[model samples]
Target: MRLEGVFARYGRRDAWVLQNVDGEVRQGDTIVITGRNGAGKSTLLRVLAGLLPVGRGKVRDRPDIVGWVPERFPTAQPFAVLAYLQGIARVQGLSQSLAQKTIDAWGERFFLTPFFATPLEELSKGTARKVGLIQALLNPPQLLVMDEPWEGLDAQSQAELPAVVEELTKNGGSCVLTDHRGRAADLGDVRHWQVHQGVLKEEDAPAPQEDAEHHVIEIVVRTDEVGTTVEWLREAGYDVHGTRERR
Candidate 1:
C-alpha cells in the first residue's frame, strides 16, 4: 500500500491528527508505529485499516481483507466467545462449516476454548484480548493492523503473537502495529516508524558489519538425509565436517 500526502483528523473543525503523511507498505513488511500517547498512532492505524477516511491525498492499494485488533477490546458486547468469532468468520466470507472449524482451531490455539461459551462481558481482560486477537485471524488477512495487541495478554500468548505476525508476513501479507511497553522484542526486523507532530519518517536500519569473520556452527540431521544436507550446506558457503552418530 502507498500513502501520498495523506491528511486526517477526527472532525472537520478538529485539528489535523496526521498531515501530509507519505509512505509505502510492501508485501511481507512488518511496520511498527511508535509515538507518545495521543500522538495519533491509533488514528494512523485506523486510516491504514480503512476505518478512517483521509481528509486529503490518497491511500492506494490497501487490501480488501484487512484484520484489525483495536487497543481496547469491547467487553460490553452481548455475544459469547464462539458466537462472536463465528460471526466474524462469516463476515470474512467463510461458510458455516468453515467458520465453525476456524473458530475451533483458533480458540484452541489461543487457549480460549474453555471460555467458548462465556459471554464477552464475563471474560477477564487477558481472555478478552485473546478473543480480540482470534477474531482478527479467523481468516488470514492480507493486511493485519494491530494497536497495542500485546497488552493484556499472558506471557505465553504474548510470545506467540509475534510468531503469528511472522507467519502472516511469510505468507506474503503485511502488518502494522503499535506498542508502548516494548514487549514485541521478537519483531526485530520490523520497519520502525515514529509519528511526531503528525509527520511520519522511517528510521534507518542498523548498519551492516564491515569486517568478515568466520564462526563455528554445528549441524545435526537424520542419517538418511545427512549427505544431501551436508552438500547443500557446503554449497551455501558453510564449512561442513563429517557427521558423527549419536548414541
Candidate 2:
C-alpha cells in the first residue's frame, strides 16, 4: 500500500493536518509512526486505511482488506462486544460460523470472554480499547492500521499485542501504527518515521550499546541486605555509597 503526495485538512480553513505526505508499506513489513501530540499521526493512519478522504493526493491500497482500530471505540453501541466484532467480521466477508469462531478466539486471548455478552457502554475504557483491537485482528486483513493500540491496556494485554502483530506480518500482511509508549520496538525490524511540523521524515534510531561503562546500574538489594552488599563491595575496593537506616 502507498500514498502519493497525500494532504489532509480537518475542517474548513483549518491548518492542514498532513501536507504532501508520501508513504509506502509492502507486505510482511511494519511501519511505526511517532510524534508529539497533534502531530497528525492518527490522521495519517486514517488516510492509509481509507477511512478519511484525502484532500489532494492518491492513496492506492486494497481497501476491501483493510482493518482500522481507531483511538476510541464507539461506546454508545447497542450491540454486545462479541456481536459487534462478529458483525465487523461478517462485513469483511467471513461466514457467520467463521466470524463467530474468530471472535471467540480473539476474545479469549484478550481476556474479553467474560465481557463477551456485555454491552460496550458498560465496559471500562481499557476493555473498550481491547475490543477495538480484537476487532481489527479478528479477520486477518491485508492491511491493519492501529492508533494507540496499546493505550489503557493492562500489562498482560500489552505483552500479548506483539504476538498478534507478529502473526499478521508473518502472514504477509502489512500494518501502520502510531504509539506513544515506544512499544513499536517489539515489532522487530520495523521502519520508523516521525511527523514533524507537517513534514514526514525517515528517522534512524541509535543502536543499542553494550558497554558497561556507558550504562546506569541499579542494585536493588532488600533494605536489610543492602548494608551487607554495600559493605562487601566497599571492602572489595569498589566505589560504593551507602545510607544508614533510621533507627
Candidate 3:
C-alpha cells in the first residue's frame, strides 16, 4: 500500500492532521511509526485503515485483506468478550464454530480465557486491549494497522507482542504501527519512520553492531556470606564486578 501527498483534517480547517504524507509498505514488512503526542500518528494509521477519509491526495492499495486495532479498545458493548470477538471473526468470513474455536485459542494465548464470559465493560484496560488485538489477528489479514498495541499490558503480555508480529510477517502480511514507547527493537530489522509536523520522514541511523563480543559469569554464595565473598575475591587480586544479594 502507498500514500501519495495524502492530507486529512478533522474539521473544516486548512490545518491537516496529515499533510503531504508519502510512503510505501510492501508485503512482509513491519514499519514502525514514532512521534510525540498529536503528531498525527494515529490519524495516519486511521487513514491507512480507511476509517478516516483523506481530504487531499490519494491512498492506493490492492490488499486482499485488512485488519485494524486502535489505541483505545471499545468496551461499552453489552455482549460478552468472547461473543464480541466471535462477531469480528464472522465479519472475517469464518464459520460459527470456527470463529468460536479461534477465539478460544487466542484467549488462551493471551491469558484471557478466564474473562471469556465477562462483559466487555467489566474488563480491565489491558485485557480489553488484548481482545482488540486478538480480533485483528484471528483470521490474519494481508494488512494490519495497530496503534499503541503495547499500552497498558503487563510484562508477560508485552513479551508476547513481538511473537505475534513475527507470525504475521512470516505469512506475507504487512503492518504499520504507531507507538510512543519506541519498544519495537525485538521486531528485528524493522523500517523506522518518524512523523513530525504532519510529515513522515525516514530516520537514517547507523546499523547496529552485529559482531560485538559479550561475556557472562555466574556465582553462588551461602546466605549472609556476600561480604566475605567480595573480600576474598578482592584479596585474590581478581577484577571483581558488581555484586548483589537476593533474599
Candidate 4:
C-alpha cells in the first residue's frame, strides 16, 4: 500500500494530525512508527488501517485482508473473551468451526485459555490486550497494523510477539506498528519512521560498528536449551561462533 500527500485530522476544529504524509508499505516490511506523546503515531496507524479517512491526497492498494490491533480494546463490552474473538473471526470470513479452532489455538498460544469464559469487563488490562492481539491473528492478514500492542502484555507474551510478527513477514505480510516504550525486539529489516510536528520521516539508525574491539565471555548454561540462548544472542547482534555442539 502507498500513501501519497495524505492529510488527516480528528475533526474540523482539530489541527491536522498528519500533514502531507507520503510513505509506502511493502510486503515483508516491518515498519515501526515512533514519536513523542500526542505526535499522531496512532493517527497514522489508523489511517494506514483504513479506519480514518484521508482529508487530502490518497492511499492506494491497501490490502483487502487487513487486521488492526488498536491501542485500546473496548473491554467495556459485555461478552466472553472467546465469544468476542470468534465473532471477530466470523467478521474476517471464517466458518464457525474454523473460528472456534483458531480461537482455541491462539488462546493456548497466548495463554488466554484460562480466561476463555471471562467477561470482557471483568478481565484485566493485560489479559484483554491478549485477546486483542489474538483477534488480529485469527487469520493471517496481508496487512497487519498494531498500535502499542505490547503495552499491557506480560513478559512471555511480549517475547512471543516478535516471533509471531517475524513469521508473518516471512509469509510476505506487511506490518505497521507504533511503540512508545521502545521495547520491540529485533524484527528483521525493520524500517523506523518517526512523526514530528505532523510530519513523518525515516529515522536513520546508527550502523553497528564492525571493527570495534570485543571480548568473549562464555556463559555455561546447565539446561538443554543452549540453542535458544544462542539464537537470542544472535538476534541481539552478537557474532556467535559455537554451533558444533548442543547442551
Candidate 5:
C-alpha cells in the first residue's frame, strides 16, 4: 500500500493536518511513525488505516483486511467487554467457539481475563486499550495500523505488541504504528518516519556494528517461576518461545 500526494484535515473548516505526503508500506514492512504532540502523526496513521479519507490524492492498493487501533479506546459504548469482542471476532470471520477460545487465550496473555465480563464504560484506560488491541489481533490483518498503541498498556501488554507486529510482517503482512514513549526503539529493523508541519520525512536507520555478536542460551526454571520468567527477556527485546523438552 502507498500514500500518494495525500492531503487531509478533520473537517472542511479545519487546517490541513497532512499535506502532500507520499510513502509506501510494502509487504513484510514495519513502518513506525513519530513526531511531537499534535504534529499530525495521528492523522497520517488514520489515513494509512483508511479510517480518514484524504482531501487530495489517494492511498493505492489497500489491503482487504485492516486492523486499526486508535490512541484511546472509546468507552462510551453500551456493550460488555466480552460481548463487544465477540462481535468483532464474528466480523473478522471467526466462528463462535473460535472467537471465545481465541478471546480467552488472548485475555489471559494480556492479563485481561479478569475483566472479560466487565462493562466497557467501567474499565480503566489501560484495560480499555487492551480491548481495542485484542480486537485487532483477533485475526491476522493484512495491514495493521495502531495509533499510540503502547500509551496505556501494562508492562507485559506493552512487551507483547512488538512480537505481534513482527509476526505479521514475517508473514508478508504490513504494519504502521505510532510510538510516543520511545518504547519502540527495540522493535528491530523498522522504517522510521517523522510527520512534522504536515509533511513526512523518512529517517536513516543506524548502521549495524560490525563486531556485535549475540548469543542465545536457554534455561529451564522451576514451574512456579515460569509464570513470570519471560518478562526480562521481553523487556530486553529477545524473542521468547516455549517448547517441550525431550525426556
Candidate 6:
C-alpha cells in the first residue's frame, strides 16, 4: 500500500500526530519504524491497519485483511485464552472448522497450548502477548502490523518473533512494526523509518558489525603468584596485574 501525504490527529483539539507521512508498504517487505516516546509510531501503525483515518491523504492499496498486535494486550478479558482468540478468528470471517484448525496451529507454534484453557486475565504479560499475536494470525492477514510486540516477552518468544515475521513476509505478506530495543535481528533486508516530531523519514541501515567480535577484559592476580601468573599470561600473550591482599 502507498501512503499519499497522510496526516492524522487524535481529536479536534489535539495536535497532529502524523504529518505528511508519505510511505509504502509493499508485498514481501518488512518496514521497521523507530522513534522516541510520543513520536507517533503507534499512530502510524494504527493508520496502516485502517484503524485510524488520516485527516489529509489516502493510504492506497491497504490490504483486505490486516493483523495488529498492540504494544500491550488487554488483560482484563473474561474469556479463556482459546475462546478469546477463537472469537477473533470467527469475527474475522473464518469458518468454525478453519478457525479451530488455525488457532490450534498458532497455539502450538507459540507453545501456548498450556495456557489455552487458562483465563485471559490470569496469564502473565509474556503469555498474554503470545495470545495477542496468535489472534492476529488466525485469519492470515495480507498486512501484519505490530507495535512493540516484544515488550514483556520471554527470551524464547523474543527470539522466535523474527522467524515468524520472516515467514509472513516470505509468503508475500507485508509487515510494518516499531521497536525501541534497537534494530531488528535475524531478518532479511529491512526498510528502517524514523518518525520524529510527527515527520517520517527513511534511514540508511547501519553498517553491519560482528556481535561476537573479540573483546578484551582485565584480571587481577595475587602478589605472591605474580611470577607464575605472569609466565602464564606471557605464554598466552595475555595481561594481568598483581594485587596484594588486604589483611
What tens digits encode model 5's per-residue C-alpha lDDT throughout 2-80? 8899999999999999999999999999888878888999899889888899999989999989999997899999999
lDDT-best of 4 and 6: 4
Query: Which pairs of residues clash in candidate 4, taking residues 3 or more apart in a chain or in different chains?
Result: none
Write candidate 1's Cα lDDT for 26-112 as tens digits.
Answer: 999999888888888999999999999999999999997899999778989889888888888887899999889888888777878
The Cα error of candidate 6 at residue 196, in Å, is 0.6
| lDDT of each residue in 1-247, candidate 2, tens digit only | 7788988987868889999998778998788998889888888888888878888888887546788888778879899887888888877788988888888888888888999889999877678888988888877788989888877665568789888888888999988899775677887888888998677987785356574674335576678787456645533434443455545
Model 1 accuracy (lDDT, Cα): 0.85
For every candidate in turn, the CA RMSD to the true structure comes to 12.2, 9.7, 9.9, 7.9, 7.8, 11.0
Model 3 TM-score is: 0.81
Return the lDDT, model 5, position 161: 85
TM-score of every prediction relative to native: 0.81, 0.81, 0.81, 0.82, 0.81, 0.82
The deviation in Å at residue 153 for candidate 1 is 0.3
> What tens-digit string does per-residue lDDT give for candidate 4 at 1-247?
9999999998988899999999999999999998888888999999999999999989999998888998778899979998888788888899999888888888888889999999999876678888888988998989999998877676567778888898999999998998765655466678889999789998775345466587987777646777566655643445556754445
lDDT of 3 by residue, 164-187 (tens): 889888999998897655568778
Point out where model 4 deviates above 4 Å: 206-247
What lDDT does each candidate get?
0.85, 0.80, 0.82, 0.84, 0.85, 0.84
- Superposition error at 44 for model 3 (Å): 0.6
Candidate numbers, best lDDT first, in rank order: 5, 1, 4, 6, 3, 2
TM-score of candidate 1 to 2 decimals: 0.81
Better of 2 and 4 by TM-score: 4
The candidate 2 region of ten consecutive residues with least summed lDDT is 233-242
**Residue 193 lDDT in model 2?**
81
lDDT of 1 at 159: 75
After superposition, the stretches of candidate 6 with alpha carbons farther than 4 Å from their true spots are 207-247
